[model samples]
Target chain A: GESVGLHLPTLSVQEGDNSIINCAYSNSASDYFIWYKQESGKGPQFIIDIRSNMDKRQGQRVTVLLNKTVKHLSLQIAATQPGDSAVYFCAEIRGNTGKLIFGQGTTLQVKP
Target chain B: GAGVSQTPSNKVTEKGKYVELRCDPISGHTALYWYRQSLGQGPEFLIYFQGTGAADDSGLPNDRFFAVRPEGSVSTLKIQRTERGDSAVYLCASSPARNNEQFFGPGTRLTVL
Candidate 1:
């Protein structure tokens, strides 16, 4: 069965520090990947996305690195803030199917 | 400019009851999706619609679950004979097109007792 998994269930970071979250996917046919953040009592918010052709994509304060060879994905947040504390999810779309298969989230906790 | 919206932010129902969840997508968005999130887990895809028809429904758990997008803008997910296992947060999302960035709505929490 195709599935996505996270390397850790929780990540604690100090304020102003950088945070890294890791994920692994089982499907080789997946081409597009996205990272989302979800706060308590809210929906998953889109953070950044990367296609299989690109290994790295950067947003305002976040970065997504993809490793096709290892079937690994990671999300990096710079200058972590208290607002950045949330559960992060990595999702992938297989081929052209619009459906997203999401991994169990990794909770990111930023300490002041 | 509004994001996806779902009605009845929360619903409480009993086993063997029927329930309907609604989702209103962003204006002009042609693609709509529905997902389910269990406690301490990520959202799971249920179905996606392109315009007025469902493009993929293979993620639907069983025949008891059904969804419809009659006008391509608003979607309704209906559950028949709901079970305790059906309790979860139902999320809706919309995008300008398929394979694009999807904006999500505050999910509807369903509690089946």
Candidate 2:
């Protein structure tokens, strides 16, 4: 069975500080990993994604790191803001399949 | 352009009743997916469609759950004999293709009492 997991269920950070969220996946064949930010009463929004061949990828204010050797994934937000507060999820594209397996989300709270 | 959209922002029904949830994917999106999210949990995959065909339905929990993308533009998820455990937020997403970035809808909150 394919599984993706987060290292933490909740994280709190002060505004303007950097926040790091970690995830672990069990499928070695997973080639694509994506990060999604979900706000209350809304849908999951695409954050950033990393391919198995790459170790790192950067977006506007976010970065995703992948460690194939350890089957780990991480999302780093620089200078987190109050609006950055949301539940973040890590998902993987199962091999060549179109199906995506999502891990438990980590709620991030940026306090002012 | 409008993003993915779902109908019936919320639905409450009695257990054992039938229900239908609709999703309208972004125009020109080649792939669409359905997911179920439980309270405080990540969304779980339910089904995927490419064009008008169901590319994968393995994620569906049981025979009571079924989904259709008849015209490839709109999709509907139908659940029969719903149970209390079926209560959750049903989410819909669309991507240009497999492994592509997915854009999600606001979701249809389903409550089975």
Off by over 4 Å in 2: none
Q: Model 1, which residues run further than 4 Å from truth?
A: none
What C-alpha lDDT, on a 0 to 100 scale, does residue B37 get in candidate 2? Answer: 98
> DockQ numbers for every candidate?
0.84, 0.78
- In terms of docking quality, model 1 is high
DockQ of 2: 0.78
| Fnat, one value per model | 0.77, 0.71
Task: Tell me the lDDT of model 1 at B61.
Answer: 100
Question: How does model 2 do on interface RMSD, in angstroms?
Answer: 1.1
Per-residue lDDT for B20-63 in model 1, tens only? 99999999999999999999998999999999999899889999
What is the C-alpha local distance difference test score of each model? 0.94, 0.93
Judged by DockQ cut-offs, is candidate 2 incorrect, acceptable, medium or high?
A: medium
